[model samples]
Target: MDRIKIKSVTTLAEHWGALRQADVEYRAADGSLHHLKREIYDRGNAAAIALFDPARQTVLLVRQARFPALLNGDPAFMLEVCAGMLDGDDPFTCAHKEALEETGHAPRNVRKICNIYPSPGAVQEKVALFVGEYDAQTRQAQGGGLAHEGEDIELVELPLDEALGMIESGELTDAKTIILLQHLALERGA
Candidate 1:
């Protein structure tokens, strides 16, 4: 932990998230020193949750636009679990808030699925993942996400099997979504 010494950091951009480059001297395992420059996108952390219905073997998901995907030659619209930036709220609170905003169901039975860094090389953000149980009686609102935040979310409820198949079929590509789905699949022994 004390092997790396930071020399300086330069900000490249400062918008929704910060893009900065850090110069550092790293001490190798054999005691050799190496200089390195690393660029990181600091968007803060986020939380995502997969809402599942055990009785129906179904999961609640969302579809929305992702400009970054489009820019990277992938599908602009992504099918994913409900998620959002913490914005100062705790991970669990953020997950619940996103669930209510994007899926209409405030899950009562929620469990952590561990935190993950999908792009450790460039992104300085960690996501706290979760899975929650829901049912027909749990509908709190007609969720389509907040229009004011430019979020045009579409609710998609599909059988767990079908959702898992989407991963193999290349329809589900979001890392957080895939991780949560695979976790749920393993829990169900599917």
Candidate 2:
């Protein structure tokens, strides 16, 4: 705390997430002071999970439209692990709820993997990552996400090996999804 000082914070946007610019004063290792302005985006926090079925050696994922990717000329619909903004729920609760809503599968015996800051350079959001086990019995509804919220999610089940291979094939590019997949693969010694 002694090394940095926030001079002021000004809100730049307050829509989906709150974006603010912070004027900061920093003390360097060489005993120099520097002034810097940085923009920070805060959307509270979120949680995500990798849904795996041990019996089938497969994982359940979701595909949905991601405007940001589309805006960058990438495909609009991207394959991703089930996830959502926490709203007011705890990380675990959010992960469970999102999994059920997006894939119609409520994972059992979920184990949290880690918490990650996907873009600490500018985003003040922390995501709790988890691994959950699922099977056919867990699927209860024809989950396509909350259609009223415009979530047109599609469930994608793939063998764990094939899903991991997609990372090398340039198919699955979502970072959270990739991290969860890699973690799952490593945990299973694949």
Candidate 3:
């Protein structure tokens, strides 16, 4: 096995917003030196949560139009989980808000499951995952998605098994959602 040693990392260009460019030098294990240049898109960070109503035997999800996925021809834009960018706020707070907005369901119980990097190649975004347990009866239909932010989300209620099946069948391609749902399934011994 060969390892690459990072000699140094330098920021080449930076914007006022969340994306930038960088350059780095590394020493190959075989004693060769190399330079790598790439753009760094800093999304600040984000969080996602799986909201489940055990009493109702249902899970909350959202269907939103994803331009990239649409371009890729995935008609099933439906996804499982509540997710959003941190936006300079606490990850837990952001996750809670995203859950309520995306599903119109306020969670009574929430737990942090994991934090992950969905794509480390270009986007410098880290997603913190959560599992929220709530009473479906108390949910409201308040139209919680943010259209100004380019979100036209449709709330969805699905059976646990069906949601899991979607994961297996590749209907759910969001990485953070997958991580949370997989953890939920494992916790329930499903």
Estimate, for each residue in 48-118, the C-alpha lDDT of model 2 and write its tens digit: 99999988999999999999899999999999999999999999999999999999888898999999999
Decreasing lDDT order of the candidates: 1, 2, 3
Work out how many backbone clashes candidate 1 has: 0
Q: Go through the candidates in order and give the clash count of each.
A: 0, 0, 0
At residue 112, candidate 2 shows an lDDT of 95
Tens-digit per-residue lDDT, 8-46, candidate 1: 999999999999999999999999999999999998999
Task: Report lDDT (Cα) of residue 41, candidate 1.
Answer: 97
Candidate 2 residues lying further than 4 Å off, grouped into runs, are none
Report lDDT (Cα) of residue 36, candidate 3.
77
**Stretches of model 1 off by over 4 angstroms after superposition:** none
User: What lDDT score goes with residue 188 in model 1?
Assistant: 84
* Candidate 2 vs 3: which has more lDDT: 2
Q: Candidate 2's error at 26, in angstroms?
A: 1.3
Candidate achieving the largest lDDT: 1
lDDT of 3 by residue, 1-190 (tens): 2344444556655663455556666667777888877777785788888888877667888878766777888774657577888887799999888887887777877888878988898888888888888674657656448768777888778888888888889878887777777787888898
TM-score of each model, paired residue for residue: 0.97, 0.97, 0.85
